[model samples]
Target: MKDTIEGFLDLVKERNGHEPEFLQAVEEVAETVIPYIVKHDIYYGKNILLRMVEPERLISFRVCWVDDSGEIQVNRGYRIQMNSAIGPYKGGLRFHPTVNASILKFLAFEQVFKNSLTTLPMGGGKGGSDFDPKGKSDNEIMRFCHAFMSELFRHIGPNTDIPAGDIGVGQREIGFLFGMYRKMRNEFTGVLTGKGMTWGGSLIRPEATGYGTVYFAENMLKTKNDSFKGKTIVISGSGNVAQFAAEKSLQLGAKVVTLSDSSGYIYDDEGIDDGKLKFIMTLKNEKRGRISEYVKEYPNAKFTKGKTPWGEACDIALPCATQNELNEDDAKTLLNNGCICVSEGANMPSTKEAIAAFHKAKILFAPGKASNAGGVATSGLEMTQNSLRYKWTREEVDNKLKDIMTDIHKSCIEYGTEEDGYIDYVKGANIAGFVKVADAMLAQGIV
Candidate 1:
């Protein structure tokens, strides 16, 4: 089994040798999915996994726009239409300086399984650019988004590929991108998610991913006759995912202690209540300020510069930040600190070594594809609302989101249970997500 896995990875590495991030994502899935494929005769000799690893289409173009300095700037943009076997290409568009082919490919590959887990008629894709939106005037950001959509619009459509916001891309950026596509196509379609509520946006879209992460953790806790009530929760990132994860955790009677950014993390032992979370929403969403300002607002919270919150003792740790944010050492620290659960709110936030540590410890851990899928699931709902030319109320959307999370949790448990009665969520998620898409691909023939 080890040799077979290595042989497959060797071939994949041959083609994607330069793409470390993409290779990492593939290796993680291959480790778990390969065993299932080996045991299943229908999937054997089909080379389905190979086809899924490769993108159906990878589009790259030049985005040219004028900056506030009246100078022309050029940035590369990409859209990896990874797999459309189940449905149309669906994912988010990130606008950050770190955006690259490797990163996008990894995300697109992960999206395939994430969307499949959602039980939605949507495939996986990811598009983004290396354009940094920070420190830019609103006009500058708008111009950049417009330029990005000018070329991206040619490849995507309401039914072909619908993009939402991620990382640097948010409501304001989505508004500009959607506006360009609408004007160019001369139609107001759901070509994009994460739009303002007044313009075909779904309620709770921003909070979907965060809320979903907490919901998943809650479900995991239930398996052990546990709950979030009175638990000390430590979360990373101050963005939409972290903020809303804190909100939902607080709602469930949990104590959220930490929130961080690139600069550093702040530990608020007193817990980040609803009021503090609102302040953080303004600090990040409106002011676009650094997280250090949080310490000033609440002096009781100590700011730890240039570090993560893993060292703090807690019951649960939600890594809502970027990929590889939590390493093996961090995982060990969390385990040593008596942390019982670690749920990912960001894509591939936990490294391979870190995951192994958690598995060795046999603690409750949820991967991003299963835990962080709420964002894409909600986007799928938004697409449905758009197609019907109707909108659902907040309660309706929220209820649907919760049901989907619960279903995902059940799917994980169904496939992830081991002989020792311990749940291997990673294996369960990878296989559960794989069976649906692999079957769809097989039914559709060798596309």
Candidate 2:
């Protein structure tokens, strides 16, 4: 079994040797899914995993747009239509300088399983560009988004590949991209998620991922007859996911002590209350200011210029930032500090070593695919609402999101519990997510 897994990984390495991110994602999936495949005769000798590694479509194009200075700028864009075995391709479009084929492929590969776990009729896919939206004027950002969608518009549609927001892509970028797609296609459709509410966006879409992460954590705590009451949580990232995660944790009677951006993290021992949270929202969402400003507004908080919040003492930690933000040392530090639960709100936020450390410590941890699936699940609901030409109220969308997260937790437990009663969430998420997609691929007969 080990040799078989190694052989598969070797083949993947031969093809994607330069793509470290993609290799990391494949390694994690193969580690668990290979054993399951070996035990299940029907899955054996099918090369199903091999086929899944390859993208159904890899679209790369040049995005040429004019800046505010009237200078034409050129950037690379990509759309990896990874798989549509279970449903149409669905994922987010990230806009950052680091966006590349490797990162997008890794994200798309992870998305395939993540979407499956959501039990939604959406396949895995991801797209993005090397054009950084930061420091760009709104008009400039709009032009870039339009240029990006002009080419991408041909490759996606309502029932086809659907892209949402990630990283630098947000409501503002989605609006511009959708406007371009609408103009080019000559119709108003739910071709994209994260659209403005008036234009067809679903309620709770912005809060879904973060809220879902917390809900999943709550479920994890429940297995041990535990809850978030009076728990201290240290969350990284002040983006949409981090903010809402903090909000939900607070609502559940947890103290959210930290929120960070690229500049640094702020540690507020006072536990970011409603007023401080509102200030953070304005500072980040509206002012586009750095998290260091958080300490300025609330003098009680201490701002660390260039560090993560993992060193803080807490009962729970939510890594809502970018991939590989938490390392083995950070994991060990959290364990030493008596952190019991670590839920990922960002895709692949923990490295292989960090995950190994968590598993060693026997801590309750939820992967992003399972814990942070709310955003895409809600997006699926948005698609349904669009098709029905109706909208769900905030309460309706939020309730559905909660139910979906709960179901995902149930699925994870059904597949992840070990003999010792330690829930190996990684193993459970990998196997459960793999079974559905693998079966779909088998039924499709070598597509």
Candidate 3:
């Protein structure tokens, strides 16, 4: 309880009543920035933190699209432009039935700092629709994407706000959205990331977050004189992030045994190799299906219901699913199972209870703001490339992404190296990211 912004927080709690995710975010920053605000003694009551937590703009629209059966389907679409103190709003569009204002607020609030931590000229924003892509025909998906982008196009631009892919919105979705944006705006720009290679998309953008998480984990492990080699890992969420995390882990000589989806978890005693991963990509991205099919295809794998892949013996855990997927019980399972490292690929996947458990266990925990920043970092690069009308090669972009992730890891250590020698990544990421935005805010000066 640092009282740097006590009154404002109290007001929020009075109004919102124990907004755990929101309160957790504020607490994480208060522990770090309070000292700095006291030392600086400049504009304490300006409500910067309060305002930063709140979104700059929240657009909620009614999206109406016609499905393949000549039926008009309607859904709620949202774009929460959280902050723009540093640069244009940059983040992802996740289309899932679970999306709402509170969830999007938590996500967009986290994105502000995550983008800042990348050391990129980007701010924070997140957009999504509650229309689930699962069980939808390609034409239906295309119409939904087009309708969503039609409303979204008016708000986002390359130099203003940029959107990328998340859980449900992948290449096909991006293509449809981009096509709609182009048709409406009548200009070609980097309004979106995760575009096809034939378009404005950059190379290696898809693999950035997953690869970067492992890279950050490796950097953290290196301080303890170790690496990913011979490590057994359990990764949740068999999406793009989890798939590439598996790929990178194999490349780093680690074995990943489990990957899950919304339905349930799949446990493979043997490692999830490239073949299995390809099957997953097809299953998830192409077929738009569940992960239980993975077990059916591989007789050696076992599918379990209503449980995560934790409790299996492992050295590392990567939770790539949505927020609050991992809780206190899951953290205890990981700790009891001898898991040492936890890096988040999704935004705030671990709850406060889970984080406290890891802290109590003294495990190496990297927050999504620090670990999963690779995606937005590359999105910023995409902006730069779009500005210059050039595309960097995969190796070139990947090398730079690696450097950025390393720098982010170093930044966390530099700021998070505390008296107890445990890195408070929440503090490190919030403080480190805040400095850049705070400076920009100061320079802009009463604008």
Candidate 4:
């Protein structure tokens, strides 16, 4: 089994050696999915995994736009149509400086399983640019988004490929991108998600990911007859995911004590309630300010520069930050501090070692693909509403989102239970997500 895994990995590494992030994402899925294939007769000797690893299409282009300074700037943009077996390509478009083939490939690879888990008729893909939106004026961002969409428009459509928002791409950026795509195509369609409510966007789209993460965590806790009624939660990141995760946790009677950004984290022993979370929303979404300013608003909270919230003790920890933000040491610290559950709201936020540590501890740990799938699931819902030319009420959308998360949790349990009865969510998510796409690939006759 070890040799089989290594041989397959060697082949992947030969082609993607320079793409460390993509390799990491593939290796993680390979570890679990290969073992399942060995046990299943239909999947063996078919090389289905190999076919899935390679993208059907990879589009790259140069995006040139004028800045507020009246100077032209260029940035590299990419769209990795990773898989379209189950349905059309579906994923988010990030606009951070860290965007690259490696990262986007990893994201797109994970999106395959994540979308499959959602039980939605959407496939997996991810695209983004190395364009930084920070410190750029509104006109500059609009020009950059328009420029990015000019090239991206040719490859995507309402039925072909649909892109939503990620890291640096929000409602404002989506508005700009959608405006360009609409103009280029001379049509107004649901080619994009995360639009304003007044537009084609669905209700609860912004809050979906965060709300879904907490909902997943709640499901995991229920197996042990536990609940978040009095749990102390620590969440990382101050962005959409983190802020809403905090909001949902508070709504469920849990006390959220922390939120962070790139600069640092703030520890509020008294807990971040509705009023405080509103402040953070404005701070990040409106003012676009640093997290350090949180201390000035609430003197009770202590601002720790250049650190994560893992060191703080809590009953639950949601890593809502970026990839690799939580490492092994942080996992161990959380374990020592009596954290019973860790639900990821970001893509690959916890390192491989950290996951191993969590598994060793036999605690509840949900991977980003399974837990953070709400965003895309809701995006799928948005697509449906857009097609119907009708919108659902907030309660209706929220209820559907909850039902999807519950189904995802059940899927993980079905595939992840071990001989000891411990649920390995990582293993469960990978295999459960794999089976659907693998079957689709088989039926499609090696396309």
Candidate that scores best on lDDT: 4
lDDT at residue 44 of model 3 (Cα atoms): 66
lDDT of 4 at 264: 90
Kindly list the per-residue Cα lDDT of model 1 for residues 1-447, writing each as its tens digit.
999899999999999999999999999999999999999999999999999999999999999999988999999999999999999999999999999999999999999999999999999999999999989999999999999999999999988998889989999999999999999999988989998999999999999999999999999999999999999999999999999999999999999999999999999988889998999999998998888898899999999999998899999999999999999999999999999999999999999999999999999999999999999999999999988999999999999999999999999999999999999999999999999999999999977
| Local accuracy of candidate 2 as per-residue lDDT tens digits, 394-429 | 999999999999999999998899999999999899
Question: What are the candidates' C-alpha RMSDs?
Answer: 0.7, 0.7, 1.8, 0.6
Clashing pairs for predicted structure model 3, backbone only: none
Worst ten in a row by lDDT for model 2: 292-301
Clashing residue pairs for model 1: none
TM-score of 2: 0.99
The 0-to-1 C-alpha lDDT of every candidate, in the order given, reads 0.95, 0.94, 0.86, 0.96
Error of 3 at 76 (Å): 1.3
Ranking of predictions according to lDDT:
4, 1, 2, 3
Instruction: Name the TM-score of candidate 1.
Output: 0.99
Q: How many pairs of residues in model 1 come into backbone collision?
A: 0
Where model 3 places Cα greater than 4 Å from the true spot, the runs are 1-6, 15-24
Q: Please list the residue runs of candidate 4 whose C-alpha ends up more than 4 Å from where it truly belongs after superposition.
A: none
lDDT tens digits by residue: candidate 4, 157-225: 988999999999999999999999999999999999999998999999999999999999999999999
